[model samples]
Every structure is written in C-alpha cells, then in structure tokens.
Target: MSLLHTLAMHRAQLPLNALRAFEAAARHLNFTRAAIELCVSQGAVSHQVAQLERRLGTRLFHRLPRGLALTDDGQALVPVLADMFDRVGAVLDQYADGRFRAVLNIGVVGTFATGWLLHRLDGFARACPHIDLRVSTNNNRVDIAAEALDFAIRFGDGAWHGTFAEPLFEASLTPLCAPSIAARLSSPRDLAQESLLRSYRPDEWRRWFEASGSPQPVLRGPVFDSSALMVAAAANGLGVALAPAAMFTRELIAERLVQPFDIAVDAGRYWLTRLLSRKESDAMRSFRHWLLREAEAETPLCSE
Candidate 1:
C-alpha cells in the first residue's frame, strides 16, 4: 500500500519478453513474420502481444484481416524500443574473449575488396584482434547511412555529399589483356584494332589513350559493371581491359594477363569515407588508422 512499494511492484511486473515480441511484431506489421524472426510460433507471438497490451492498458496494433497496423502509441514506442535494443546489443557484442571487442561494419568497393583488402585482411586481424570486422562489398556506389555502415571504402575524388573522406591510394587505369592479346599491341594506337573491354565508366579507355598521346579510338567493346569481371574477361582473351594494373598483381605475376603499355591514367583514388553526421567509434578509429598505415606502406608514392 506504500507508494515506493507500488512503484517497485510496477517495475517487477514489466514484461521484457512481451515488450520485445510486441516491438518485433509491430516492426513487421505481421505476427507470423515476427514469429519467424523470433523463432517462435505465431500463436506464441500473438499471445505475447496480447499480454503486453493488457499490461499497458492499451491496444498497440489493429488486427486487420490480412495484416497488422500500429496504433499511435505503438508508433511512438517502436523507435524508443529499437534504440534501446540496438544499444544493448552493441554493448553485449563488445565483450569477447575476456576483452572488449568493438563491432565495425564497413562497406567496401568490390575492386578494392578483391584486389587489396581481402589479401591483407589477415594482417589487420593480427594487428587489431579486439575489433570485430564485418565487411560487405559493393560497387562504387553506396549509401553509408541507409546501409548502417560505419565506413565505406569507395573509388572517387573524395567529394561525396555529407561525407568525410580520406584518400587511401590511387588506382591508375591501364590496358591489360591475355599474353596473346598483349603480343599484338606494339603501341597505344594499336589498341584500336582490338576489342576494348570496358567498365561502367565509358571514358576510361579514352583517358588512357589520351595519356598515352594516342588519338582516342571509337570503342565498341562489351561493358561490364565490375572491374574484376572486366579483368577476367581480358584474361580469358575476350578483349583488352582498361583497369588498375596494381589490382591484378596475381594475374600479372602468373602470366594470365599482361600490361601492354607502361602508361596509366588516374581517374580516381580509393578513399575511406564516413558520414559527417556519424561520430567515430573506437573501432572505426582503429580500423582507419590501420588502413592508412597499410596504404602508406604499400604505396609509398601515393599521397592522401
């Protein structure tokens, strides 16, 4: 009957599981889907939501004939619960192997991921074992905030809107192809006679030709969405590919592909970018430092 006792009882009666069930159900607007996500039966999810509604003394969702719709109260509560869960999950993830391990989610360009980062990732793991790294590879385009990524390694001029960028290294574009194709190319002008395999960017071959002091030729090669595939096509003797020669070190060393000319054109550099609105976490800072150090060691001639 005491005020303090009543408050304590109220706190004790707060159902955490029911709250989570309701939140998940509300997010999906479907009890069945929420049950699937929570790995429970639909009846259990419905019961939890019903229990939560009774406790709160209000209806949080409307049970439609086909789907569910959140009430005003539910809409207001969803974000708060979501944030609370996220913060708690983040804290829990930080503790591993008797040490704090911060989770860092980064999106990298496919070219850089395959060409450089994947090969040297072991070194990063050794250097910073306390950081949990989750990497996703994308094309040059990405939405850092929408994807909830901590950092994005992309190829550009470091001018993305609402992003802070640090240059990693320059990936100069050059003509690469199978040895059979390379043997026929005595001059940059000779590229006109072969199938000039192209990437999404149409001006790459033109830029290389201009840099080589050769007149730009009319290109009628197949266009690929990724440099990796473009290089693969060239290695298979389909056509000459204009790509970053440094990225295909393995192919070049194995004699699967060869650079016919020494000339390379700079289109853009790889950059470590994060949204300006995002504050750097401990893990992000650590990874950024490690990346910059590695870039410096690998490409001493390239400047940030």
Candidate 2:
C-alpha cells in the first residue's frame, strides 16, 4: 500500500486516546511522566501506547534501561501529530461567543503600512476582535492570487486588469525636503541644482515639475523601491523627494521633513484591491467598511 493510504488506515484504526498516550509518552520519553500528565496509571498509559503500536504494526518506542526513546517511526509521527493537534486547538479557539475569528490576510505597501495603517491597527483590533488580521508589507507590487492574499492596499490609478479596485485616498505628490534644504532660494525652478531622490517610477519628478509649471531637470540620484525609506533619506538632507505630503504628516509635523511647494500632482491614489473572482468574506467586508470609514474621516476622499 502507498504510504499515504497506510497512514490513513492507521488513523482510522487508532483511537485518539491511544494517539494522545503515545504523543505524551514520546514527548517526555517516560511512561510514568506521561501517566502523571494524563492523570492515569502508568500501566494504563503503557497499555494505550501498546495498543497504538499494535494498531500501526510497528514498535514506536524503545524500552531503554533508564526510561524510553522513540524509534524512527515515532520520531516521524511526533511532528505530524503535534501539528494536527495545534491546528485543532487553533480552530477551537475561533469558536468563542459562537463566532469564528476569521483570518484576513492582507498585503499593504510599506508607505501606507507604516505611515497610516500601523497607527490605526489598535483601533481595528478593538473594533473587529473576531477578525484575525495578518498584514504583510510590499512596495506597491503584489500578486493577490499568487500570494494568497485576501486584500491589497497599493498606490496606483486603480486600473489593474483583474482586480476590484476601491480608492482609499488621493495621494498627491509634492516636493519634500529637510528644513536646511528648504532654506534655499524659493521657486520651483530652483530644484534644478538639488539632489533629486528618485523612486523606481521615472515620471514622478517630471510630473511634479509639469504641475508646478517648471522645466524638468536632468535627473541623477539614487532610486528607492520604498517611499518610507525615500522619505527618510529626504528627511536626513540627502535629496529632494517628490512624495505624498499627507502620508508623511508625522515627519512634517516633527519638522524632520519639509514640503517646499503647494503644487501637487495626481500620480495616483491609494487603493484597496482584491481579485475580481474572489468573493468577499465577512472579514473582508468588515475590513473594507472600516477602511472606507477611516479614509472618509481623514477627508471625504474615498472614491466610489
């Protein structure tokens, strides 16, 4: 018989008590210890383990002079049984108040994750205690289906081919720099001489220049994949960053970074996206509603 079929047959033949006895005995490598743990007599524990071994048609333990040791088959079974028990316990935990604590896996761009979402996570946890939220950060490039993500918060024009995009907020790009850098002579044209920090996107500076009615200068600077890091570089007086001002409000408020001009470009907005084929779950709906409400409170800017 195939190994899978053999294991399946063993599972059918073996009782849970027998499996538990073996697991506890294997863990401690002693029948008396396992008996104490299970609140049963040592003989009962040994009988259960012998029953399990007979059912499997394999000796699971070696009766050593000092105590006990697991055989190769016992070693192989330990982790599998432990994992199954852990999964069962986790599922049981989700049954509180007759509500399942649904798991919601979401991917977020680093910029939003750190600047906005992190601060509000405690509020989300309190409001949706029945939802187990798992967040992973990216750099605006994500594959929802491939990554097994239920939702993704990204920066873009909301035009992905197979996604249902819901706009969160308009993230406008403005020229931001350090206070020392901001002290330079005024005028959008003055950006000609500054070190222009760049994102992987080549057109942000150009767009900002066009929006400010200034000529785009020859770009030469380090490229960054994450806006949070790029903004940090700008805050450290490295170069001028064309970034969203609203997202860096904390840095701006602390005077770590300074915005040089009011002119902003509509590169795109932050969007909550999921695969068009994925049906919305209760957790997904709760998250979307919470996100939209929070985004609205920031300003009535969540797009339809």
Candidate 3:
C-alpha cells in the first residue's frame, strides 16, 4: 500500500482514546498509573490498549505479573506519540491571548540561578513576552541532550567535550565566613584554626591559601556538592566556606556572610554552553544575544 493510503486508512480506523492510552501506558509501563493520569479506570485503559493492539495487528506489550513491557512495535511508536503530544500541547499553549508563544527550555547551575539569573529574569520576560521560558537548575552538571535542554549554564574551564561554550564571566574563589568568624580572624593564617567547609573541588582551598601567601592547611571538614549549600553552611556558622564571591552577593549584602580576607583565586568561570551538533533555534539566538548583552552590562571592562 502507498504511504498516504496507509495513513488515511489508519486515520479512519484508529481511535484517539486507544492511542492516548497506549502512549501513557508505554511511558509508565504500568496500566494503573496510566489510568490515574488519564482519569480512567485500569480496566478502561487495558481495554483501550487491547483495541489498539487489535487494530494494529501486532502485540504492543508483553504482560507481566507486576507491570508491562514494550515490544518492538510499542518501542517504535512511543517516540512518535510523545512528539505528537508535545507538539499538540505547544500549539494549544500558544493560543493564549491570540499570540503564539515560543517555548525555550534552559538548564542552569543552582548558584547562577539563585545569585544572578533569577534576579534578572523579570526583565527578560518583559522584553520577550512572546518567548515562554522554562528553567531547570542543577549543580553545575547537566546532560543537555538527555534532559531535552536547549542551553545549559555551567561553571567550568569551558572545555566540556562536544559542547560549544561561551564565557559569561569569571568567578573567583575566596574565603567567606560568618561575621563572628571574621571578627576572630586577623590574617589569612587564622583560617587554619577554624573549620574549613569544602566543596567537591579539593584544590580550591590550596589555591586560595597560596594566593593569600599562606601555606595550605590540612582540610578535614564536611564536603558539600554545591557552592550554594557550602555558603549557606558558612552563613549559619557551621564553618568557613571557600566559594565564588561574585555569586554570593545577596548574602554578602545582607551581612549573612563576609569575605574575611581581600585575597581571591581564579578557580574557573561560568559559561553558556550548548551541544555543538545542535542547530541554534530562533529562541536560542534571542536568549544568547540577551544573555551576552546583560553580562557585558554587569561586568566592567578591563583597561588594555
């Protein structure tokens, strides 16, 4: 049969309810959860799935005692149905106020989201009302392709494999502590007597101490996976945290955390990264231009 003729025949014969049931069930691999999602009973879901299997003339799933598993046919159909549903949802969402809204999905590091991006998002929303921005925050580690992200704002040396990274700005590391701890310290050597909260990066304190003209002390403290959490601990007087001072301006301004010394070290920088193989969409281009302009405005240019 011709492709068009096959599609027409299926269009006439296939039921939309059956397709929806199958898609939901295939995604969850459990008819009960799919039933709850569809607001239908388990029997209803099972009936719809059976109807789809009969019409397609193929067994879509392997029924187990506990749950369900997709056969080759089900696996092939899942992605198509998921994409179709997403497209439908996107179109329906754009119908608000008779304006078409373009959806943009961006992932950012938690520190950047809290300290910088969150504050300036209102401006972006106002400037680009037609773009619907969705954000997800991580701890400077993200898989753009797997997470279905258009862009990922990460902190590193801008050398991630298979990614195109544009430097946003440098974030230097410095010793930040509570006011009480700062009051007790007179010089960089005083840090050795206090608890040093550490992050995953082992060499950060060593580099900071070297920059401060002090010998690196033996660090035996609770390690945090994120700078945001480490700074929080420092603010709460748990220990002194060596973190990026630029990203913790709110805490510093509120006097919750203070930079004890004038010394700082260049650990790495923040970068706006995207998959090298992915083509830039219109929304991506707009966001990139807006981000670069904002970064330039925020950071002072160095004298040549």
Candidate 4:
C-alpha cells in the first residue's frame, strides 16, 4: 500500500460517534452514563465502542463491573480528541450570530485574575453580554500563540515578541497578614522574626524590605506557587506575605487581612496582550473597550 493511502486509511478508520462515545465513557467510566451523555442506549454505546476497538486492533478500555478504565492507548488519544471536539464546537458556536462572534480565549496570570478581575467581572459581563469570554489562569508563564489564546493578562514589562502589549494597571507589593499577625508586628524589624510566606517570585520580599528601609530578612520560608495562595496563608496567620494592595483591598477592608506597613514595592504592570497575527473580532474589540474602561474607573492604590 502507498504511504499516503495508508495514512488516509488510518485517519478515516475511527468513526466520530465511536470517538465521542469513548470520550464520554472515559470521563464518566460508566457505559450507562456515557449513553446519557451521547443520548443513546447503553447497548448501542457498547456496540459502537466495540467496533472502534476492532478497527484499531487494540482494546481501548479495561471493562470493570462498576465501570471502565482507559488503556494506555486510550489515555494518549483522549486529550487530542477532546481538544479537536472543543475547537470544532467553538467554531460551530461562532456561526450562531450570523457572523462569528470571535472567541477571545484568555489565559490570565493568577494573582490579578483573582485579586482584581474576579471582583470586576460582572461589569464586563453586563457590558458585552453576547461576547463569549473564556478564561484560564496560570502563574506568569503563558504563550499566546501555543495555547490558541487571543489575549493574556500577564504581569511584566509587556515586551513579548510578535505581540502588542497595552498597560492595564500597575501593581505594588506590601506586607499583608491577618490582623492577628499584624497585632504581633511591633515594628518592621519584628517582621524579620516571623514566618514570611513567599511567592514563586523570589525578589518580592526583598524589594518590600528595602522599600520599608529595613534590612532584608533572610529569604527562607514556605514558598507558594502563586501570590493568591501565599496571601491566603498569611490571612490564616500562618505568616506575613507581600502582595499588591489593590488586589487584596477587599480582604483588607473586610479585616480578613491587614497591611502592617505602608511600605510598597513596584513589581510590574498588568497588561492586555494580543498576538499581532490575530485579527480583532467585534467581540474582542468590545471586550477590550469594556476592560480598559473598568481599569480607568478603579484608581490604583499606588502610582509610579
């Protein structure tokens, strides 16, 4: 057989219904539940999946009395198939408005996403009700191109290549803790003896200390994956954490946490970034205008 012909045969071998059935069954692990998801009978789902296994010459699942477990082959195929389905669904949904609504999938940096955007999302929702906004959060590391995201809310100088970065807001780091912990802090010097919760960004604590005109405390403590988690630990009186005061304002006002010192350090600005190749859809434009307006209305806690 020719290489191209064999490749075509391989691609054409898996039936879409069988793939869908397998995807759902892999998720629920029960044939009955997969049938419900597929809107078909349990026996039909089993038959379709069996045909798929026969075609592939591999058993994709290990049938258990209660449910099923994906074989190694099934494990490898699920994510790829899931993504294919998701992208197909997204494209299909775009056609509903007569014109594609232009999906803007955003991967936000975790701190600002929790600290600021979550509180203000209702405004964006009201402003652009038709624009479908999908969001995911990560630490500072994200790729606009690889993730198929049109934009990213990232914390840094906004110098990413092949992209345009617009400064959204500035964030400053300060010592924040539970009021109980604040009560124990007699002075900036007293902080040196306390358990200092740290974020993955190591320079924050040192910068806050220098801004406070205090000796940099020995940087040793529980390191957290994200600032939001670190602050939560601080709020429990576990330790003091450095974070953007603006992001943590609600917590401070509710007395869930307190800023023990006025000293603040400039970390980086939050930015709205987009890839140059990505065209601005009506939905993208609408969302951006709304977001910029929201940022403008809210005064930054610190000015550079």
Candidate 5:
C-alpha cells in the first residue's frame, strides 16, 4: 500500500458515538446505568460497547455477575476520552452572543488570590463580559510556561529571568493573631511568649523584628507555605502569624484577626508576570489593563 493510504487506514480518530458509548459504559461499569446516563436502551449501549471492543481487537471489559470491570486497555482510554470531551465542551460553551468569548488562563499565588484578587474578580467579570477567565492558584512557586498559563501573580522582588514583570504593591509583613492573643501582646517584646507561625520564607519575622527594633524571638511553630493558611492558623488561636496586614484586611475587619503592632517589614512585593516569549491576546490585554488599574487604585505604580 502507498504510505498515504496506509496512514489513512490506521488513523487515530474513530466514530464519535462508539467512543462515547464505550467511555460512558466504562464509567458506570453497568450497561443499565450507562444507558440511563446516555438516554439510550441498555441493549443499545451493550451493542455499541461490544462493537467498539471488536473494532479495537480487544475485550475492553470482563463480564461479571454483578457488574462490569474494565480491562487495562479500557482503563487507559477512559481518561483520554473524558478530558477530550471536557475540552470540547468548554470550547463549545465559549460560542455565545454570536461570538466566541476569549479564554484567558492565569496562575496566582494563594495569598494574592484569596486575600485580594478573589474579592475584585466580580468587577473584572462585569467590566469584561466577553472574556472568560480560568484561574489556578499556587504557593508563590509556579512554572507559567509549563502550566500553559497566560499570566502569573507572585510575591517576590520581580527579578525572575526571561519574563516581563509589573509591580502590583508592596506587601509589608506584620504580626497578626486572634483577638485573645493580641490582648496579651502589649509590645513587640511580648511576642516571645507565644508560638510564632511562619511561611517558608525564613527571614520575614526577623525583618519585622528589625523594623520594630525588637529582639527576634525563637520561631519554632508550625511552618506553612502560604500566608493565607498561616493566618488562618493564627485566627484559630494556634499562634501569631507574621504576614501582609493589608492582604488580610477582611479578617481584621471581621474581628477574626488582629494586627498587634504598627511596625511592618517590607520584605517583598506582589508582581504580575508573563513569559518573555508569550504573545498577548486580546483577553490578556484586557485583563492586564484592568489589573493594573485596580493595583493603581490601591497602591499607585509611581509610589515605589
């Protein structure tokens, strides 16, 4: 056979219904349940799955007295079909209002995502109705290119190589704890008696102590990777968390947490970044503009 003819005969794609039928049956492991889900008769579902097995030259399932069990080959194919169908469905949903809504994917550190961005996303949605957003959160350590993200919001010095960076705001670290714990902390010196919750960054509490001109206390409490979780632990009366006070304003306002001292350590800043080679789409541009404006309203870009 000619090369092109041979390739055509063994192409990857099969009939859509056959794949769908096999996938649904594999999920439920029972023809009746799969039929109910697919709105088809049990006999039809059984026939389709059987036909799929024949076409693939292998038995996809083992007949059990109570239900079906997928073979190794069937196990491998189920997730592939599920992911493909989900992606296809997401794409189809974007076609509305006679135009496709541009999809933008972004990764954000948990602190900024929960403490600041989550509260303002409603405004972003309203302002850009034609743009669809997909957000994933991390612990300030993320690979934007590997994750296939359009942008990433991280906490650092904005000195990452091979990326474009925009400074959002300085998140000065301060001591925060529950109201009960705050009552005992008359001064920075009083923190020596309590547990000191900390993030992976080892120098935050030390810098805050330097800023307050107080002797550094021993930090042997539980270590956390995200500031949000560390503060949550503090709110639960576990310990005193040194974090960005401005980010946890809601907890302070709601009386869940208390900032015990005015001294804050300017250890790092929040930044929006993208890979140098990433091409900006219309959705990306819209989001960038909106995000920059929001950041400016909170902390002006020129304020340093």
Candidate 6:
C-alpha cells in the first residue's frame, strides 16, 4: 500500500471496542470481572480481546487455570490507556450545562482557614452562585505553581517568592485550656505542673511566658501541626494549648474553652497570596472584596 493509503487503512481499522475490552480485562485479569464492569457478556469480552490481539499482532494475556496474567505489551498499554481516559473525563468535567462554571481553587493554611473562613463559606457561596469554590487546607507548606491554586490564605510575614502577598489579619497567641485545666492555673509557676501542647513553630510558648512576666516553665508536650487541632486537644483536657484566642472566639464564648492568663504573644499576621502570573477571575475579585469587608468589620477598634 502507498503511505497515504496505509495510514488511512490503519485509521479505519482501529477497533475502539476491542481496545477498551482488552484494557479493562487486562487491568482486572479476569474476563468475568471485566464483562461485569463493561456491562457485556464474558464471551463478548473474550471475543473483543481476541480481536485486539489479532489487530496488534501480539498476545496480551497468558491464560492460567486460576485466572489471567497480562503480557508485557498489555502491561505497558494499561497506563497509557488509563491516562487517555482520565484526560477525556477531566475535559468533560470542566464544562457543565451550556455554560462553564468558573472554578476558584484556594489553598488555605490549616488554622484560621478552618476556624473562620470554612464557617463563613455559605455566605460567599450565596454571593456567587455560579462560582465553584474548591478549598484545600495545608500546614504552611503550599505550592501555588504545582497545585495551580488561584489564591491561598497563608499564615506568615506575607513574603513569598513570585507572589503578591496581602496582609489579612494579625494573630495573637495565648494559653488556652479547658475550664478544668484553667482551675489549676492560678499562677505562672503553676503552668510547669501541667502538660503544655505546642505547635511546630518554636519560641511561641517562651515568648508568651516572657510577655506575661513569668519565668519559662518546663515545657513538655505534644507538638501539633495546626493550632485548631492543638486547641481541640486542649479542650479535651489532653494538655494546655497556647493558641490565638481571636481564632477560637466562638469556642470561648460557648464556654467550651478558656484562656488561663491575660498574656497573648504576637504571631505573624495572616496573608492572602497568589502567584504573579495568575490572573484574577471575576469570582476571585468578588471573594477578595467580601473578605476585606469582613476582616475590617471583625477588626477590633482598639487594634485599629
């Protein structure tokens, strides 16, 4: 055949059903299971695989008494076919209805993101019904480029490479414990008698003790990934957690937790960040506006 004719014939002779059947059967290594998965009879699945083997001029499976095993060719094709199918599915999932719903993927630092923004998501949802919001929480180790996040709420000094970081709000850390634990905390020296929970960040507890005009007590406790989790542990009476009271105001007001002392240490402020190359969509703009308004309203007059 001429090159053009051979290419045309090859395209025309491609067996989609056979390829799909072989891919599924090879993945499962059971014709019966592949038949059930593809909603076809076992005989049909077997016939499809036979046709695929003939087309490819290679055996794809080694039939055994118990089950089936994939040949080298089949093993290689499995990942390739799987990737192709996944790409097709992802493309279809991006477009819903007649219009494409804009997606705003956000990565949030575990602390305030969970304690505050998560609780207030309903309001934002109502504001932009068409905007699809996808939020994932991380422990300060976020990759804006790798994750393709449109924006992220992170806790730090608001300095990140290749990104514009806007200050959100300052966080203050104080010693929090259950009322049962608080009853034991009459003096600074008394803190040494109890187990203290700490976060991965060093110097927090020591600084808080200095701010309170108390000597550094013997600090022995479990280190936690997030303040939210640490405070929850403290509320459960596992240990005394030094965290930001502003982040846990609801818990304090509900009497679920208490601050044992008036001392609060200044941790770095939270920041809203996005890569410089990232273009803000209309939905992101709306969210940014709403977030600034809410933050301003929440900021205490004395702090301002």
Ranking by lDDT: 2, 3, 1, 5, 4, 6
Candidate structures ordered by TM-score, highest first: 5, 3, 6, 1, 2, 4
Segments in model 2 whose C-alpha atoms lie over 4 Å from true places: 15-86, 93-100, 300-304
Q: Judged by lDDT against the true structure, how good is candidate 4?
A: 0.82
Q: Write the residue-wise lDDT of candidate 4 on 205-303 in tens digits.
A: 777777778898786679988888888999998899887777877898999999988878887788899998998877778878888988898757531
Q: Candidate 1, which ten residues in sequence have the lowest lDDT sum?
A: 1-10
Cα lDDT tens digits for candidate 5, 96-156: 5678898899999997888788989999999999998999999988999899899999988
What's the TM-score of every candidate structure? 0.80, 0.75, 0.82, 0.75, 0.82, 0.81
Query: Can you list the residue pairs that collide in candidate 6?
Result: none
Model 6 scores worst on lDDT over the 10 consecutive residues at 1-10
Clashes of each: 0, 0, 0, 0, 0, 0
lDDT of 2 by residue, 192-244 (tens): 88999999998888887888888998988799998888889999999998887
**lDDT for model 1:** 0.85
Q: In model 2, how large is the Cα lDDT of residue 238?
A: 94
Q: What does the lDDT read for residue 287 in candidate 5?
A: 97
Please list the C-alpha lDDT of all candidates, in the order they appear. Answer: 0.85, 0.87, 0.86, 0.82, 0.85, 0.81
Using lDDT as the measure, name the better of candidate 3 and candidate 5: 3
Predicted structure 3, TM vs. truth: 0.82
Question: Tens digit of lDDT per residue, candidate 3, span 1-304?
Answer: 4333443578778898998999999989999999999999999999999998887777889999999999977887888789989888878987776888888899998878888889999999988888999999998779999998999998888999999999988777788899999999999888888999998878888888878888977898899888889889999999899887777877889999999887878777789999999999988999999999999887621100
Candidate number achieving the greatest lDDT relative to the actual structure:
2
Clash count, candidate 5: 0
Q: Write down the worst ten-residue block by lDDT for model 5.
A: 1-10
Stretches of candidate 5 above 4 Å error?
A: 1-13, 53-59, 62-66, 69-80, 96-99, 145-148, 159-163, 254-256, 300-304
**Candidate 1: lDDT of 132?**
88
